[model samples]
Target: MTVESAILLLPWIALVALDRRALAGDVELSTLIEPIAARPVPGEYRTSIAYYRAVLALRAKDARSARALLDAVPRPLPRKRHAEAFEYLGALLDVVEGATERTLASAAAHEHGPRRASWLAVRAHAQAASGDVESARATLRMLRALRDPQLDLASVARWELPASRLASELMRGEEHPFR
Candidate 1:
């Protein structure tokens, strides 16, 4: 492999190693975020770090803090990271703040992207939260068609799986009467 290819491959290999280790035991979200946030990277990468921290905050049930962090995310995120950030942020808004309509709108706006499945999944949760069962089911049907496995492992291990699973259940007909 060329030097450039080798350089790119190393990050992926490290991420895979981290994923395996995370699966073996509990991985702290803050532990993952702090290091990334401390070093100055490109603005685009910093936006992703901020978004991940927001996801961690939401997972910790701190909606207020999550919103604050999310608000600080720089606009016009790098093209490569934009869709995933939007999907996760929308889901967090739906779950934490109960802003179903806004979340759904945000998710729907990104439907044409590579992260469509993730956006659909978040939209499904938003619809379910809004008591729109039919819409949620339709969104899930779309997601099933795409079959994106990354949806299951999108965020840090401590939060991503549980949050996505909860969102899936909410979409799959479990009535959340409490909003």
Candidate 2:
């Protein structure tokens, strides 16, 4: 990797380590967010910074901040570098905030690709949150049909991890139409 790529990769490496630590319930969200956010001009590490910031905000019950930060992420991010961002953004909108319509809309804005499975998962979660069990099940079926073993770690961490912990707390358990 080039020096620039190496430099950019370091923070995410550290973040993955920290996320693993957090998964073990040994670290605090603030501990993760402070270091990442304090780094110089995070635009170079935009997706990582944004993902962790949104995670921290959600952990702190600061949904507004999380939403703003996630919404600000630019689309068509670098194919290699942006996978986590798109995944996390979808989770934040569909699962964390119970914004299914918004998540589906956002996914629609992007051209279809392998990434669609992750997006569809979020849409499923949104549908589930809205009490549309049938639709949610269908979406999940579509997600499963993708047959892509690739998992978006960021999205899984943002949505499934928290949902496993907090259950009904992440999504409000109400249908929110796409706006």
Candidate 3:
């Protein structure tokens, strides 16, 4: 490729690299939020920025902010993302909005294939929250059984680590402190 061609591809290449870093849990959203928000980007890129911002908000334990950021992400995200917006939106509503027995039931009853682990982890937490520790343990065991080394770290960092910690607490006979 010519130098001009390489220059033209630079932006795309940088975006992809940033995505990889985001997935690897190597990059934090706060660090990227400013530069991304400073410029006007569109479509999938915009969706990605909103996704990261939501993650940051969630990490700070601010569900309301995460919900707001998630609202900015357009529906039916372009299929390249790890967690679909619809699915996460459902989980977010369950975990942050209503999160009652009805919410847990809805989340548990849903058919989430590729996203099963994430969904299940949330469901388990819901179970624990509702004081059904046994059911929560079972659900978390199911999540642990589904663990695969090949799954991307981004998803793991976003959900699994917390689930694992909860599971560990369950095993040690302590009530899971997570909300």
Model 3 spans with C-alpha error above 4 angstroms: 1-27, 76-83, 109-112, 150-165, 170-179
TM-score of each: 0.62, 0.55, 0.65
Q: Could you give candidate 3's per-residue lDDT for residues 17-60 as a string of tens digits?
A: 55545544444536655565555565666666676677666667
Give the C-alpha miss distance for residue 159 in model 2, angstroms. 2.5
Candidate 2, which segments miss by more than 4 Å at Cα? 1-30, 39-42, 59-61, 71-91, 94-99, 108-111, 145-147, 152-179
Task: Sort every candidate by lDDT, greatest first.
Answer: 3, 1, 2
lDDT (Cα atoms) of all candidates against the true structure: 0.57, 0.55, 0.57
By TM-score, who's the top model here? 3
TM-score of model 1 relative to the true fold? 0.62
Which of candidates 2 and 3 is the stronger one according to lDDT?
3
Candidate 1 — which residues are off by over 4 angstroms? 1-27, 78-80, 152-179
